[model samples]
Target: MSEQQKTVALEAELDALRREVQRLRARNAELEADRGFPGRLVDALPSLVYVLDLEERRYVYWNRELAELAGGNIGAAAGPLRGDGLSSMFHPDDIGRIEGYRARVAASESGEQATVEYRARGRDGGFRWFLERGVALGRDPEGSGRRMLGSAHDITAHKHTEQMLERSESLLHAFLEYTPSMMVAVDVEGRLLLVNREIESYYGMSREELLGKVVYDLLPPAASASIRKANDEIAAAGQPGASEHVLVYPDGPRNYLSTKFPIRDAEGKLYAVGTVSVDISRTKQAEAERAEMQRRLIEMQQATIQELITPLLPLARGVVAMPIVGTVDPARAEQILTTLLEGIAARKARIAILDITGVKGVDAHVAQSLVGAARAAGLLGTRVVLTGIKPQIAQTLTMAGADLSGIVTKGTLESGIAYALRARRRS
Candidate 1:
């Protein structure tokens, strides 16, 4: 046959098996001219072509490719294969489906074809996927097809690639849907390309509404400005940007920590941007609460120290004395006066003693505070006695013009307590 005629004949068989009925009709007229050409051409085709005996479950006629696929060269004897021969090469999981496919093909109409996908075990013991197009070569006497012509192409690589893509897509979908963080992908123009379920739920927008919307338009003005600045920073620096922003919702303002990064092509050119945002309002509230608690605790501690610095002791039933230690500020001096009067009222004390032995240099303000304490004690039916006074503090009180007329003086705290007890006995 001429090359052009050979090419035409080869395409007719390899590519036109789906129209096997029409091809078989024309094949009879060309059989004499084609002679051995069809056999050699079928053997040269990439796919495996076979005419099977459906009733016996064996190949009646197959190409050289089927022989190699069926392990003829590896171990099987060099001849036409026998009973259960071709069916045994199919995977165990698919062995049942093969019988169904053959039954369907046998029952098919003259021009109809049955397409099925199945895995078949190769000679090397690995299973490979096959996409087969089979049809009835001829029908039996009972109006059922008994012979089938099939063209099978190996599709294992395509199947594996599709499976991997599907798995990756499923994993990405699950992460976006279930993760707590809000994630979004936007094109360079700031249009939203992808948004997770969390993002949609957080913003109270449906996926249909959120998609294709500009991210900047959806966010509050301040938040969008911050996001825009962060995007610009990363775009210039070629790194990810992280920032904290406040978004005002219908309820209130919420704090969010967001990280923005560029999605780049393999050549390192930016194409889009991705953002992951997490709400930090609870964390900020916790920090504020901790700080407030610390402030309150410090105030409580200072109040406790004020009491510890000036401890009022009841020397007798009708008298009390407080030994003031350390330097006394006006605030502490006022605290001292308040404690003295309260102690006198609570104990009904007639005599109160102030110990200034531990007092540092008293300023004019502190001296006046002490003088006021003496006058206030006297009004409460208590005589305020100054005890353990240093000479410099006495000089300071005199120089400050503090009145000492009603206030009694003593050399020591023990002496003051003795005088108070004796005075109480006399009264």
Candidate 2:
């Protein structure tokens, strides 16, 4: 080849090489820009970002976010870290979990990722929940060896939310336990789901043991049927209903007033039934006593009217006599006067005898009542004979200064009857 031709070929080669060098420089600039962009963004990010070398078992590369989290700059944070050294920040309680996760990551050689939630100690000496995720980078070209790159994300907020929900549930259960009335919750099928402490007496069993059992199982057949019917109605209506029932417990039957209502969810769907029972045994007993007293009062009134009116039904021309017994108090005196006056008018008797043969004693007020009744009878045209005055009664009458001037007195009921008959004949 000629020298000049070789020079031309060299120049051509030089031009092509220069073009290639310029292209290479442009590409390098783009790559540098991209690298610095990601690095800066990652360093300034609020969340920690990291790459783990599973084989070395340490954080390979970390951003400034992680460095700040470790209480240092990136250089200082990475200086002491070899592979797998990030485990040092794991809480003691989570060390076993971290070791297990590391083992899982190392064993995974298929380029797949492993994720776990674990606790890590912050620089502030507090533990934070983290979700650790790792994937094998390139331990094997066929993805059959363990070489992992991993990152952890803080999930403390989510953990806190879960813990708060658990606490709220515990508080609710505690409140139910301490409530006074017997409270119970049952599923749609009428199986008991929850029962409060007060239900222990009603069911005759521990609340724990009663769960999942049908309410009918603890009640008498008749009472269970009635309660079940009411519950069904309330559930169907999605409202409240109340009933009084007798619960047969181990101790025996006890009365209770039970109120039942349906429990609904936010969307207005029927979920379960809630019930509260109040002990009404005392109130029931009081009501019964009131009823008995009323009945006795009615009976007494009827007996009084019957005794006063029965003897007057058949009127005769002969005399009618009323014999009173027992100590004569003011109330008894009033009753005797009322009976004698009413009987004289009813029977149209010309003469009537008021005998206190069995009377052992009398007060001054009673003697005065007797004299007044005799005067009232005389005005009604029926001659009154006051009979059966014993010695004591006579003494009391004298002491009372009661005027018996026109009242006829006899010592015995027999004499009074005889005197009444003679007076009736004379009239």
TM-score of 1: 0.64
Model 1's alpha-carbon lDDT is 0.84
Candidate 2 residue-wise lDDT at 135: 68
What are the per-residue Cα lDDT tens digits for candidate 2 across 378-413?
899877778878888888889999898878888887
| Candidate 1 error regions (>4 Å) | 1-67, 73-85, 92-117, 130-158, 230-262, 265-268, 279-290, 314-318, 329-350, 359-382, 391-406, 423-427
Instruction: List model 1 lDDT by residue over 142-207, tens digit each.
Output: 988777899999999999999999999999899899989889888877888899998888778988
Question: Considering every candidate listed, which one attains the maximal TM-score?
Answer: 1
Give Cα-based local distance difference scores for all models. 0.84, 0.77
Error of 1 at 3 (Å): 52
Q: Model 1, 348: alpha-carbon shift in Å?
A: 7.7
Error of 2 at 385 (Å): 7.6
Give the TM-scores of the predictions, in the order they appear: 0.64, 0.52
